[model samples]
Target: MEYQWNFAPIFAHSDALLVGALGTLRIFVVCLLLGLSLGLLVGLARYSTRRLLTWPAAAFVEFFRNTPVLVQIIWFFFALPILVPFEISPMTAAVLGISLNSAAFSAEIFRGGIQSIEPGQWEAGRAIGMSYAQIMRRIILPQAIRRMLPALTNRGIEIFKMSTLASVVAYVELLHQGRLIASLNFNPIETYTVIAVAFFLFLYPLVRATYVLERRLGRSD
Candidate 1:
């Protein structure tokens, strides 16, 4: 069967698609901020001298890193309420799930960046009587963060793509909105094509940014 090509349906609901796209972007931004903050803390904790602190952070990173994000999202959306008897909106659950899952992977990225710094840098900081926190905050973290920017931007693209999974929990992100339009119009091709274009529009800039930063850093190195 030949499919008829029609972009009009997608354009007809551009307002709704825009709303959903904005919602997806909002979730992505919030989750990225929260995840990056939590990842930094967890990364530091994993490097702590205390085994108690380090072990928990290690466990968290391992568990989330090893598991699929879709499974984690399902657990948060479906199982959490059953286990804890507390209600969370689907959007909230989606954001929290994505943030928490992203945190684990990002923690490892941060840890790698931190470890890649030369031992001499740490010794230099300590030689100057810098406290551990001061050393990390002032010297190590700044350099590590700059080094990790490309990886972090890549993760941002991943998170934006993963935001589509929010539809599973009934959060009306772009994919969800597209699916709704497809269902109503019986035009899956156009709906999905638009969704794909929208996703590319969102992710391509981050990819370019990553490339630019990587080149800049490589030049300096």
Candidate 2:
């Protein structure tokens, strides 16, 4: 197949791409913070002694983890208003949906981190007269987080890439903007090449950071 290459249109709309990039960043940062916070709480809850606490947390993790994120996004964007009584913009809906979905997976990651700690560490903490909460905070969590840092970094990269799904909900993220530009100029190949490059530009640093953290953690161990 012979294809004519035109880089001019992509460059001409660089400003729009920049705006879309900012939006993608905004969604990612907000989602990461909120998701991590919620995930930590859910992870802790999953380990709780109370059935009331643990069951709900387990249910949430199962439901979200088992379902596709795209379905969840569609539900939030379309059915949420009917189920509830509040209005939400598509962008807000998209961000909230992805954040909550990511939280479920992150909770599992946190649980694994907590469980990976040697039982001897817990025994030592208790031997030192520390309460469960104190031991978790002062002894176990620190080491577990250090061990989990690479996994967490990888999750961040995954969430960043997943932000492309925001286009489905009419959130003007990078891929959506690229599509719009292509639609106007009739240049899918050129437009998508630029979009792919932009995605790489954003994600490459995160991949590098993950590798670096993995190495550092390996050395510390």
User: Which candidate number would show the highest lDDT if scored against the true structure?
Assistant: 1
Per-residue lDDT of model 1, residues 25-63, tens digit only: 988998889888999899888877899989999999988
State each model's CA lDDT, in order.
0.88, 0.87
The residue-level lDDT of candidate 2 at 8 comes to 97
Q: Show how many residue pairs clash in every candidate, following the order shown.
A: 0, 0
Pairs clashing within candidate 1: none
Candidate 2 residue lDDT tens string, 1-221: 97778899889999999989998998999889988889888998887789999999999999888887778788888989898998867788878778888899889888889999999999999998999999999988888888888778877987898898888988988988999999999999999999898889888987897788778767856
Model 2 clash pairs are none
Q: Model 2: which ten-residue window has the lowest total lDDT?
A: 212-221
- How far is each candidate from the true structure, as Cα RMSD in Å? 1.8, 1.7
List residue ranges in candidate 2 displaced over 4 A: 217-219
lDDT: worst 10-residue window of model 1: 212-221
